[model samples]
Target: MSSQPETYEFQAESRQLLNLVVHSIYSNKDIFLRELISNASDALDKLRLESLLDSALDADTSDLHIALETDSEQRTLTVRDNGIGMSRDEVVQLIGTIAKSGTAEFARKLKEAREAQDAAASAELIGNFGVGFYSSFMVADKVSLVTRRAGEAEGTRWESSGEGTYTLAAVADAPQGTEVTLHLKPEDTEDHLYDYTAEHKLRAVVRQHSDFIPWPVRMETEKPKEGGEGGEGDEAGGTERVVETINSMKALWSRSADEITEDEYKEFYKHVSHDWTDPLETIHTRAEGTFEYQALLFIPSRAPLDLFQQGARRGVNLYVKRVFIMDDCESLLPDYLRFVKGVVDAQDLSLNVSRETLQQDRQIQLMHRRLVKKVLSSVKSMRTKDADKYRTFWGEFGRAVKEGLLSDYENREAILEVSSFPSTHDAEEQTGLRDYVSRMKEGQDAIYYLTGESRTRLENSPHMEAFREKGLEVLLLTDPVDEVWVEQVREFDGKPLQSIAKGQVDLDGEKDDEDDSAKDAKNAERAQREKDFGPLLGWLGTALAEDVKEVRLSSRLTTSPACIVGDADDVTPTLEKMYRAMGQELPRIKRILEINPDHPLVTALRASYEKDSGDAALTETAELLHGMALLAEGGELKDPARFTRVLAGRLAAGL
Candidate 1:
C-alpha cells in the first residue's frame, strides 16, 4: 500500500457528462441508491475478473452480494460489495472520469446476458453504463468511493459533489471490493439512515427493478435474534433481534404456474412492472425440449399510463438461468404488446457475449418465434372461461393485438383467434374471426365488416341494411386504428376482409349473377318508368352536379334514398377527416351517389321535372337528399353552410 499520497483531477468533458448523468439522466431520486449499490457490485465484479488472472486476490472473498450501512447522526449511507476490487490507479481513472465505464463495460459483458433482443440483453443495458455511478449525485451532497483492486497495490478514495470536478486520493487498508458513501440529502436523512430502516424502500426498489439479479441482493434486516443474552443495554435483548433474508430471491418463471398463487403473481408483477395494481392475469409455462425456456407473462387490468406514447415503457424483464439480465425487453415481445410484463428465463443460450451481439444472434430468432406463440396462445386461452374479462382486455388492448397478425406472420392465425370486433350478435361481446367463421352460413363465404367512428352510427348506417336484410352478421369496427389493422390483415381464418359498404355488394348471390331474373325485371320496370318521365333524372343530375358523383340507380340501398360509397382506390370522406385529425394531409374523394328507385321522393322528383321543377324549394329538397345520403355513410357533407342556408330559407317559406 502507498504511504505517499497522490492526487488526480477529472477531465473537463468527463466532468460535464458526470454532472449531466447525476443530475438529469435519472428521474427518481431513489435511483441514486441503485446506482451506488451497482457501483459496489461493479467493484466486486472487477475483483472477480482479476481473480481469474491472479488466484491470490480471491483468498479472502466470502460471498458476492450488495450490503448497506447507514449512520443517522452523520446522515450518510454506504453500499459495499465483495465481487471485484480495483486498484488506486483504476479508481482514479474511473471515478474521476465517465470513462470509468466498468459498469458500462460489465453491461456489455454480463455473464448472465442471453442473446441480444432476447429478454436478457435488455437487462444488460441496465447493467452497463457510468450513468448509474453518477446517479449517486441525485440524493447526496457529496459521494465518496474507496476501492482496493483485487490484484492491485493499494486502494484509492474518489470524492465528488457531482458539480464539476473530482479529486482522487490514495488511501490505505480497504478490503478487496468497493464501498460507496452517500451524504444523504436532508429530506431522507434521519429516518432513512436510522439502523438501515431503508428496508421498506430498498425492498420495494429491489422487487421493482432488481429481483432477478444473479446474486442474492442482501439488505439489512432486524429480526429478533433467538435467546439473546438478556442485556439491559439493548432494547430487543429479551426479544432477540437478527438479520434475515428480505427478498425471496426465487426465480418466479422457473416455477410451475399452479404453484404460484394470485397474490404472489401480483406481487411479482409489481416488482417487475413498478406498477401499483395487481395484474389482470398471468401465464406461466415451462418449455422444455430442443432448448428449454420458462415464461412468466402478465396482462395488466388497466392500460398503462405510457401505453400509447412514443418510445413508451417496455415493461417485461428478461433472465438467463434465473439470473436477471435485462429489463424492459421490447424486442422480447412485439411493439404492439408493450404493456405486457414479467420475465423469460431461457436455457441452452450462451451468457458470454455482449448485449448487441446477442440481439442479432440466431438464438434470439428462435426464442422470439417461440415467445410470440406462447403469449398469443395464453391470450387465446383467456377467451374460454372469462369472456367478459377478455372483452375488457380487448377493449383496452385489442388494436395492439390486431397488429400482431399483420406484423408477426408466423403467429398470424393465433393472433386472429384473439382479434375482437363488435358484431350484430352482442355489443358487449367482441366477435373473434374464428367465431365469425364458425357462425358463417352455408354457401355464404365472405366475412362482412363495416367501419365507422361509433357503433350507434354503424347500426343506423345504410351500409349495414343489405347485410342485415340478408340475415348476415357484420362486424362493427369503430376504432380509428381498426381500419389500418383490417387493411393490413386483409384476411383472417380462411376468409378475406369484405367491407359491406363497398360498391354493388350482392350478399344474396354471386356478384355479377346476383338474381339475374330479378335484375331483368327491375331493369324492365325502370325502362318503362324512364319512358314515362325521362327528363327528370337528367335534370336532377344537372341541378346538383357539384355534389353528386353520377346520380345512378342503387342496388345496395334498401330503406334509404341514397348513400355515399367510395370510387375505386378512393377513401370515404369520414376516413379522410380522421386522417386529417391525426395530422395526415389528403385530398377529397367525390362520393358515388346511389339513388333508391323505390323511394316515393325519387318518383316525385322525377314527375315534378315535367312541370317547373326549377322551383328553388324543390331544388333545395334535392340537395338535401344528397346531403342526407353523404351523412348516412359517415361522409361529411360539403357546403354545410349552404345546406344550413337552404334549410333556413325552405323552413321560412313553409312557415
Candidate 2:
C-alpha cells in the first residue's frame, strides 16, 4: 500500500455540483447531520443483514449502533457506524461517481431556482436527485471518510474539501464500518448555521429527524455529578464523559395511534420515503391473530419522480420480528399501490427467509391481501372524510389507481368507489361513481360514459350530441386505462357501464308516461323513416364495405349528420390503437355508420341516389359521409387520401 495519498480531480460537473452544495443547495443546514445519520443507519442495517447471511463472516454483531462524536477544540463533528462498510472501489464508485450523475440537470435547476428566488424549489431538486452523502459539505468546509469493509482486513480513507479534487489512500488499523468526520465551518448564526459540535444541538437534530431509527444513535455527554462530587477531568465542573443513546429508537409501527404524535409519524415517513414534504395521510394497522404483521404505510402528498418508471423502486420495506428482511418487497403491495411508502414488520415470518420464498410464502400473500384492502379502504375513507385531500391524492396518483381496475378484479368495486372522473355534468369538477349513480337521470338504466383523448374532444364528439340535448350526464374518461377498465367493469351499483359511442342508446324508450296514441305515432314515424332511408343505407353499406360493417339511421345523433358506433362486442377505436401500438396485430374492427335521416345531406344523397342509382359523384359522397362519421367519433379513416380527393371534387363541383 502507498504511504502517500493519491489526488484525483472530480468530474467537471461534479465540481460545479460541489460548489452548489457547499453554497446554495441546502436551505436548512441542520439536515446535513440527518443525511449523515441516515447513511449511517443504512450501513448498520446492511451489516445486520450481512452477518445473518454469512455466519462465518468476520464481523462484530453484538452491539451494532451509530455514534456521534464532536470536538470543540478540533472544530470537527464525526458520525460513525459499526455497520457494513465500503471498500476502496465502492468508495470511488458510490461517493465519487454518484455526485457526477445528472450534474448538468442539477446545475440548471439550481440556477433557475436561484433566479426565481425559490428556496423550496431548490430543496425539491435535491430530493429528486439525491445529495445524501455530499450534503455534508453544507455544514463542513472539509469532510473525510474512513472505512473498513466488515469482512476485509484492508481499509480506505477518502478526504475532500468540496473543491475540484479529493485524495484517497489505503490506511492501516481502520475501524470496522465507516466514519465520516466533518471539519465544522465557523458558526454563522446570521445564516442560520449553528455549531453542530454542541451536545444540545446534536440531540435536537437527531430527535427531530431520526428519533424512530431502528438502531440506537448514541452520543458522549458529560455525566452528571452525584451529591455535588467532582471528577478528575478537564471538563467544566470536572464532569466525566458517559456514552448515552440520544434517540428513542422506538419502532413507530409497534406503537399505538394514541401513543404516537403526528410529528413522530411525519418524521418516520420522511425516513422511509426520503420525501421532504409531509405525507397526505398515514395508515396504521395491526393483525393479532393467525399471521400477524404491523403496517405503517403513508400516502405521499406528491408522486415521486420514479413513480411511473419501469423497474423503479417500489413496495414497502419488509421486516421480520423488528429485523429488516428486505426492502422494496414487491409482494406486499400490488403494482398500482407502488407509490405507498412505509414498513411492514411481520411477526411470524423467519428472518432468514429468502426473497423468492417470500414470493411464494402463504403468510406473505395473506399480508399482501390485507395490506391492499387496507390501503384501498384508507383511500375510500379519505374521499368521504376529506374531499380536498382526496382530490390531491387523486391528482397525484389517480392514473396509477385506475390501473388496479385492469388487474385487480377482487378490488375493482372498491377502486371505483374511490375513483372520480370529469363528466359532462360539470366542466371543472369531477364526479365519483357513487355520486354519478346518485345523480342518474330518472329511468336511466345504464351509467353512460365516453372514453377518448380528452374532455374537450369527448364533449365535442358527435356521440355526445343527443346526451347533451337531453341534459344527460356522461363520464369523460380520458386516461389510457379508461379505454380498458370501462370494459372490464360491467356495472357500478347495478347500472351497467354503457358507452354512448357503442351500439345504440335510446333516450325515450323508458318514457312510460307517453300516451298510447303518441307512442304509436312515434313508432310509426320511426318505421316510415327507416323504410325511406333503407335503400340509401344498403347502398352506402356496400359502397363503404371495407370501412363500415353496416349503415343505418341513427337515434343517437341529433345535430350531427353522421357518427360512428362500435358493435356491442367490438373493440373501441382508442383501445385498438393502444393494442396496435403495443405490437398487437388484431383484425381490423369494423364500426357501424349511423346517419341522421333528418339531416339535409342524407336526404339529398338519398334523393340523388334514387334519381341516378349509378351516379359516380354519389359514390364519392357516400365515402365522404363515412369519413365524416369516423372523424366525428375520433376514429381514423381507412383511406384518408381517397376521402380528401372526393371531398375536394364535391366542393369544386358545388362552387
Candidate 3:
C-alpha cells in the first residue's frame, strides 16, 4: 500500500472556469453526474474507435456500460465505465487542462470513410465535444478521474476540485475505460441533480436531458409493495435488486408521421421547442423527388410571451437517420418561417453534414417548400364562418403567415390565400385575401388595399374616401406583417393586389385628380373654392419645406382638411418606418398633401395664409395641418414638439 500525498491547488484559469461552470453554466447541479457519466461514455467511445486497428483492445470488456454508485453519508457520486482508459502521460495531457480534442475531432474526420460504406461508418465511432467533460463542474464540488488506456502500461489518476488546478499521478494496473468520482456540494444534496438517493429526482433528470444518449443508463429499482404473500415459505421473501434503463429514445422522425400519435408529437415539440404550449397545427410531409427526406413540423397555438426574446429558439430541429444531429438547421426553411417548430430529418445525408449545408440543404429546401405550402394550406383550412376559431388562430400565428409571404417568393401565392385582411369588409367579420378576391365585385380589376399602423386607424383612413364613395370595398390591411407581405404577394389569383396609396386608383373610372367639371354648378362652386385656397396650398409647401411634395386641392379628402398620400415611390411613410426598424435611417419624404376645401379648418387656413402673407404664424399653422395628416395616415411625427406647439398656438389665437 502507498501513502497518500497532499492534494494540489487548482490552476488560476482552471479555478475561474470551474467557478463559472459550477455557478453559471448549469442551472442544475445534478448535471454534474450526467456530465461525468457522459465523459466515461466518451472514454468508451475512444477505445471503440481505437479498435479499428486492434479489435482485441476491449475484447474482455462486457456490457460497455456506465454505472453510478452513490453514498449519502460521504456525499459522493461515482460514475464508472468499461471503455478506453488513459495512461499517466495521456491523463497529464488530457485532463491536465480543459478543452482538448479527445474524440470529437477524430469523429468528424471519419465521415468521408462512412460515406463509402454503411459498415465503415458504423465501424468508426466517436464521442464529439470534449467540453461535455467540463460540464461535471456544474454539479460537483470536486471530481477524481481514474483511467487506464487499452493495452497501456499503467493507469492514471487525475484529480480536480473545479477550483481549477488538477493533479495527475500513475497508479497500479486498472481495467480498460474510466471511472469518475464526484464530491457533491451541500446545496446539491437538496437539488434534483445531486439527490441520487431520491429515486424520482434521479429518474427525472435522466429522462429530461440524457435519455437519448446512446447507451444503457441504469438505476437501482425498488421492489413493488407486498400485496400478495411472499413470506419464508412463500414464492419470494427477500427484496431483489435490478438495474433499469430510464431513457428508451426511439427515432421519432424516421417513423411515419401517421404512425406517431399526437401525444408523441407534443412530447417531441416540448423537447425541441422548449415550449410549454400545445401546437395549433402540424405540417408533416415526405418529399420524394430529386432529394428525399421526411418532415414533421408544428405551428404553436399561442405565441410564446418570449417568442421574440433574444436567443429564443429558431430554425427546425435537424436529424439524420432519426438521430438529433443539430438544432439550428436554418437550411430546412427560410428565416421568415422561424416561428415554426419541428424536425427536418434527412435520411441519406451524411451524419457529419456541415452546418453551412445544414443551412442550405437542397433536399431540405424542397422539403421546406412543400412544408410551407402545407402550413399555408392548414391556415387556409382554419378559415370558417366560425369567427372565434379564426380569430384565435390569427391572434396566435397570423404574423408568422405574413412573414412567410413576404420572405418566401415560391410560396407567396399560397401565403396570399391564408393571410387575413381587415376590410371595409364587414365590421364584425375578417376575411382571407382569397375570400376577399372571391367576393370582388364585377369589373373590379385589382384587389385594392389600404394600410395603416392599426386596424382602427386604417378603418378611418382618408385614403379609402373615394373607394367608399364608389361602393368599392377596400381591404383594410393593418398588420405590420401586412406591410411586407403585400409587397411580396403583389397579386392574388391573377388579380394584382394594389395599394390604394400606390399607383393610380380609379373610382368609377375617375382618378380623384380628374375634374368632374361636367357634374353641375355646385361642383363648379367646389372647384372655385379649391382654387381660392391655391395660395394657401403654395404657402403650406414652403412652410413645411419639402414635407409636402405638392400641397393641392382635395378630391380624395372627404371630411378631413388634409391627408398624407403614399404619394411618392420612395417617400411612403409606412415604408420609411419599416426600413428604419430594420436599422436604416432615412430622411423624411415630402408627401402630397390633399386638402378638403369643404372642411372649415382649410377655409380658415386659406384666410389666415392670405392675410399674413409672410407671417410666421401662418407657417406654424401649416405645420399643425400637416401633423394632423400624418396622424391620420398612421405616419410617425418627425417633430412631435412642433406639432403640439403649433396646435396650441392656433387654439390660443382663435379663428
Score residue 655 of candidate 3 by CA lDDT.
61
Displacement of residue 638 (Cα, Å) in model 2 is 4.0
Judged by TM-score, which candidate is best? 2
> How much does candidate 3 score in TM-score?
0.63
Rank the candidate models, highest lDDT first.
2, 1, 3
Q: Which ranges of candidate 1 are over 4 A from the true structure?
A: 1-64, 68-214, 219-248, 256-261, 321-324, 348-359, 441-443, 466-471, 507-545, 581-584, 612-621
Q: How would you order the candidates by TM-score, starting with the best?
A: 2, 1, 3
| Weakest lDDT window of 10 consecutive positions for candidate 3 | 120-129
Q: Write the per-residue lDDT of candidate 1 for residues 114-143, one digit (tens) a residue.
A: 323243332223323334566566677788
Q: Which residue pairs collide, candidate 2?
A: none
Comparing 1 and 2 by TM-score, which wins? 2
RMSD of each: 10.4, 2.2, 11.4
lDDT of 3 by residue, 1-655 (tens): 1224335665554454444334442234554455565566456555554554366664445566667667778877777887777777777666765544323333333344344444322221211223446666656678888777778756777887776567666667666678888787665334435455456766776666555445567767665435525555434554555677766645566668677777767656654564544566777777676677788788776675435556654788666666446666677666666777887767777665666665465665666677767766766776644466568877776776677675677777776666676678798677777778777777778888876677687778887777777777788877776766666665777888777876444354433344566445556666787677777777777777757668777666667878877542544567677798889998766667777787898888777767778777777767778888888776778889878877887788776
Best by lDDT: 2
Q: What is each predicted model's overall lDDT from 0 to 1?
A: 0.67, 0.88, 0.65
